[model samples]
Target: MNDAQALLPEAIWRDRIFNGDWIPALGGSHTFTEPATGEQLGRVGLANADDVTRAAGEARAAQAAWAATDYKERAGVFRRAALLLSKHHNELSTWIVRETGAIRPKADLELREAGAHLLEAAAMLTQPKGQLLASASNQLSIARRVPHGVVGVISPFNFPLILSIRSIAPALATGNAVVHKPDLQTPVSGGVLIARVFEAAGLPKGVLHVLPGGADAGQAMCTDPHIAMIAFTGSTAVGRSIGELAGRHLKKMSLELGGKNSLIVLDDADPDIAAANVAWGAYLHQGQICMASGRILLQRGIADAVIERVVAKARNLPVGDPAGGAVALGPLINARQVQRVHGIVEDSVAAGATLLTGGSYERQFYQPTVLTGVLPGMRCFEEELFGPVASITVFDTDDEAIALASATSGCLALGVITPTLARGMRIADHVPAGHVHINDQTVLAEAHAPFGGGGTSGNGGRHGGAADWDEFTQWQWMTIKTEAPRYPF
Candidate 1:
C-alpha cells in the first residue's frame, strides 16, 4: 500500500474526488493534529472556490442519470455501504477518538449510529412516493417526489461520522448527488472515512464528493448555483449566515443549530437516578453534543440532595487520554474550546454563582464542573458552555420549574424527571423543544427519529427516518387531462 493509503487505509485520501476520479485540490492542503496528544495526524487537501464549483457542477451532471436509475439499485449501494461501515467500525472509532478526543465508548457509539443511518436510508427506499389525489372527472392529478438535483452538506466536528452520514445517506437514497464539507478539525474521521465507505460499496462515481476545507470552501458550496439545497449542522451564528445566503438565491436550506437545553428534576424523583442521568448527559463526550444539558432545574424540595449526589458522581468520573484507558470524560476538541469553557465558568462564579466542584483545567482537559446559585442573568446560564459544566438552579413550584426551563430562546431538547409519568408528560408538553425525555436526560438521539429543534435551534428541518426526505427532495404536482377542459376566455 502507498504511504497515504497506509495512514488512512482509504485510497480516496490521495486526492479529493471529482468527476468520479481522485484529483488534487487547487487550494493546497491543511494539517490536522490529534487533540489529545497535540501530534500531527494527517494533512487534508483544501478545496478552493474553483474546486467547490467543479464539485457542484459534477454532482449536477451526474444527478440526472443517478436519479433515473432504479430505486432498488440505489438501495443496494446503501446496504453495501452499511455493511462496510460495520466491518470497519473499530478502525473508524479509533480515528474518531484520535481526531476528536471522544472517549472510546462514545466513539464506538458514533460508528454504530453511522451504520444505522445508512441502513435506515436504505429502508427509506421502500417508502411510498407522493400520494394520489382526488381530481375532477376529466383530469388525473398526482404529486410526485423528485430529487433536488444536488445537495450541499456541512457537518460539525463532534460526532462527525454520525452527523455527516445522517445527511449523506438520505441525499443519496433520494436520488440526489451530494457535495459534503466536513469540519476541518476532523476530516480524516469524518470526510475521508465516509468517502472510503461509499467507494468500497461500489457507489456510482461523481455521485458523492468529499471536500475538506475552511470557511471559504463552505461559502462557495453555499452560494454555488448548481446546488439545489444546503443541509448544515453547526452553530446558530453560522447557520444564520448560511440561511441568509441560501434565501437570497432561493435555495432550500435545512439547519440543525445550537442548543441551550434543560433537564428538570422534580421533588418526588429519586435523587440518585436523577444525578446519574445528569452526569451522563452533561459530561458524555465532554458535553459537545447539541442536546447536552446546559441547565439543571431542581425543585426546592429535592435540590440539596440531588446536588450532593451529582457532585459525588462528577468527582469520581475519570478524566484523561481517551485512547489510554477507561475514562468517563475526554478532552475538549481544541485549546480554544478549553479556554471558552473555563472563561464561562470563571465569569459565572464572578457573577455570584457558586462553583460546587470542578473548575480546573490543564491543556485541553477541563474537569467536569458543577455550579449552583446560577440565576437567569448569568452568562453561563444564558449562553451555551458546550463543555462538562452543569449549572444548577432551584425552583420553588412546578409553575416556576416550567418557567425556568422554557426561558431559553432556543430549545433543542428537554428532560423532566417526575414521580409519575402524568406529571412528566404534562411538563414536557409545555416545553418547545424538539425532543423530550421523561425520567431521563436531555442528550439523546436515534438514527430513525426526527432529530431537529424549533425556534433558533433549527430551521424547522427534520433529519433522520422518513422526515429527512422532505429536506433532500422536492414535491412536484402533475396533472394529466383526459378530456378537453371548458373555460371562459
Candidate 2:
C-alpha cells in the first residue's frame, strides 16, 4: 500500500471498531478541524455512557491475556510501532500540523520525540526495575511494575500525539488495558493516530481502545468501575473535576494539570540569553503549554536591559502558517483561546501594567506580547494565560523574586536565570515548582527525567525511568523456605 493509504485507510475506524472486531459507540459524531486554520478534517464519535461501558467491558476481558504476555514480547511490539512511526513520519507530521497548527519543525519534533519515547518504553518494559532487599526476614518486598486492570486516559489538545502516546506506552508495557478519551479538538492526532499504531503492532483488539469525543465520554470513563486508574493531562479546572471523581471512586490517578510558571532573572544573568529564552517559552505553541513561562521576574538593576533584549528577540518570531516553515508562532487553537489571551492582556494593561511590545491579535493569531510593572491583581499575573503573553516584573532581592514566584497557587514548572551557581542553587532550593531549570528557558523533557507539576501540576511521579513504568503496574510478592521446619516431623 502507498504511504497515505497505509497511514489512514478508507473506513479504517469503521473496520477496526464498528465491525465485529470491536464494539462501536452508539453516540453521535462531531466534525474535527484544524485549530490554526478552520479546515474540516474528519469526524469523531461523541461517545455516551453505554459506549464507555462497552469499552470497559472489553478492556476487563482483555486484561488477563495482556498481563500474561511476556514483557519482551510486548516490548517488541512497541519497537515495531516506533519503526512504523518513523517510516511514516512526514504523514504523521502533516496530520499533526494540520490538526494542531504546530509549526513543521515543532510538529516533526513531537513526532520524532514520540517515536523515541516509544523506543525507550520498549527498553524500559524489557527491563523493568526490581525491588531492593532491605532485610532477610522482612524480604523488603519491592514488586516490579505490573499494569492496572484498566486504565482510562484523557489527553489534551496542545500535545495530542506526544501526551497520548506517553501514557499509552507505559500502561500497555506494564500490561494494563486502556480506554483513551482524546480531546475533541484534536482527536485525529491523539486518538485515531495512536489506535492505528497499536493495531500495526498487532496489539490485541480490546487492549487499547479510543473514544474520541467530549467531557461526557471522559466522565463516563472516569466513573466506570472497570477503570483502575485515570491518567489525565489538561487544565486545572477539569483536572480537579477528574481528581474528585477519581477520589470518589478511589482509583489511581496521575494528574498533569495547570501552571502559572515564572521565569526569574538575577542581576548577574545574561540579558541576551534570558530575554531570548523567555520569549521562546512565552511564544512557543502560542504559549498554550502549561509549563509556559508567563511570569518573568527580573532583578531591579537589570530590568531595563533585559526588557530591551526581550523586545529585540520578540521582533524575530514570525507568526503565520505553521507548515510554511518560516513562522515561529502559529494561531491559537480557536476563538475562545484568542478571547482568553486578549482578555488577560487587556486586564493587565488596564491594571496599570505597561505594554512593552506586541499585544494585538490578528484573526486567530495573537501577537507576541510583553508587559511590565505587573501586579498580582492582573489576570496575567494571577492566572495561567496559556497564550503568547509575557509579564515582566522588577524585584529588588532574591527573596522578593521567590516570594513573587510563589504568590500564585499554580506550581508546575519554573525557569531560573542567574550568573552564579550559588545564587542559582539558592533559587532552586526555594522555588516551589516541581521542575526548575538554572539559567534556561522553561521546557519539558521527552526522556531521562521527571516531567509534571506540583500542587496543581500532578501527583509526585517520575516518567522516564523503569520505576515509572512500574508505577503503571501493581506488585505481587511470593516467598518460600528452602529448608523444612522441624515441626513438620
Candidate 3:
C-alpha cells in the first residue's frame, strides 16, 4: 500500500522454501492482514506435511557438510548476517510494525536486539568446547560437543524477529541445519525477511530453510525422523504437545513457554519507581511478552501510594495507531486477542476485582488497564492474560507476599522492588523463577544471558549465551589409552 510495504517480495509472497529456494505449497495459501488497519497485506504459502518433510530431509542432508565447516567460517556468516540485519533495520522494523501492530519503538527495539543476538551467537563460537575429564584409570577421556544434525525451530507471532532468531542464530552457530516454521500471522517479517538476510550473508544453500505454515506443518516437523531436536517458543499448551511428540521419538526439545510473572513492591520501595517499573513490565507491546508482569504484589504499608502512581501512569499512556507516531501502546495482534483480553478483564471485575482506571477497547486497541482488589482465586490473578492489564493484590506480611508470588502453576521470572539491595536478593533467592530481578521488573531479557524458566514455563532448557550450546548439541566422550587396559575375562 505504501513505499515501505512495496519492498516486500511479490513473487514468493505465497511460497515455502526448500534448498534455499522458494517453492509453492501444494496446500492452499492463507492471506495475512494488518491487525491495526484490517487490510489484506498478502497471501502466504501454507506448507503441508509433504513440504515440511522435504525441508527436514534437505536440512538433514546439508548438516554434515555444514558441521564440518570451520567454526570461524560459520562465525563469519553470523557476523555478516548481523551486519546486514543492522543495515536493513528500518525496513524490517516497518514490516514488523505493519504485521504485528507493535508500536514503532517496540518494533525498532526488536530489530536492533535481533541483530545483537546474531552477533552474540557468533561470539559463542569462540568459547571453549567440551572439557577433558578427570579419570580414575590411566586413560585420557574427553567430552566433545557435536551438532544435533537438524533442528526444527517453531517461533511465535509476538516479537517475531527476535524470538525466531533467538533459536535460529544459535542453532546455526552450533553447526546444525535448521528448518524454521514461523507463525502464520507473521509470514512477512518473521519468515521471508529472515531468509533474505541470511541469503545476503552468503549462508549456504539448504543450511537454513524457512517454511511458513500452521499446525500440520509443525506436527510434521516434530515427527520427522531426521529432525533431531525441536526449539519452540509459544503457549504452554502447544509446547506440551510438541514435547510429548518429540519425547515419543526420544528427540531433544528446548521449549520457552508462557508465564504468569509477578512483580512485588516492598513497603520500603519508592512508589514512583515501583509504579514506573510495573507499568513498563505490564503494558509494553500491549503486554504480549511472555515475561509480562500480570500479577502485582504490593505490601499493605505501601499499597495505596503505589496504586495511585500506577493508575495515573496507566491512564496517561498513549494508545493509538503505531504508524501514526509517538504512541506508547498499539493494537493487540487480532480481534480474537482483543476479545480474549476484554473477556478476562470483565470476568475478573465480575468476580470482585475492581477496575482502577481503564478497561475499555475500540476495535483491536485496548486501553492500558489496571485492577485492584484482585485475589488469588480470580482469573485475573491466576491466568496469563497476556494483555495490557495488571492486577494488583495487597499482602500484609513478607511471608504472605512471597507465598502469593510463588503460588502459580510455574515461575518464569519474578521481581522485587525494595529500598535495600540485600532485601531484594533475599526475597529473590526464595522465588522459584529462573530469572529474578532486584529493584527492577520481571520482563527483563538480554541476548547473552541464560534466558529460560523452570517448571511449566520451560522444559529446563535454557536458550541463550552458553546455555544454547548445550541445548542445540549433544556430548560424545572420546577415550585413548597409552597401554592395553586390563579387561575382566
Give the candidate number with the greatest TM-score: 1
Off by over 4 Å in 3: 1-8, 12-18, 135-139, 481-489
Segments of candidate 2 deviating more than 4 angstroms: 1-5, 14-24, 132-144, 482-489
Cα lDDT of model 1 by residue, 97-147, tens digit: 999999988888888888889999889888987978999877889998898
What local distance difference test score does each model get? 0.88, 0.81, 0.87
Residue-level lDDT of model 2, residues 1-489, one tens digit each, is 574567765366642332114345578777777766687877666677778888899899998998888877888989999998988888888888888888888788888888887887787765735565454673344545456799998999998988888888878877788898888888778888888887887887788888876777888888899999999999988988999988899898888888888889899887788888888888888898888998899899889998998887777678887876688888898999899888888888999999888888788988888899998888888888988887888899999989998897768787888879898889888878878888787866665466776677776654655545645876766444556456955
Q: Residue pairs in steric clash, candidate 3? A: none
Instruction: Please state the error at residue 427 of candidate 3 in Å.
Output: 1.1
Compose the digit string of candidate 3's lDDT tens values, residues 268-333.
999889999989989999999999998999999999999999899989999988877788998899
Residue pairs with colliding backbones in model 1 are none
TM-score of 1: 0.96
Of the candidates numbered 2 and 3, which has the greater lDDT value? Answer: 3
Q: What are the models' TM-scores? A: 0.96, 0.93, 0.96
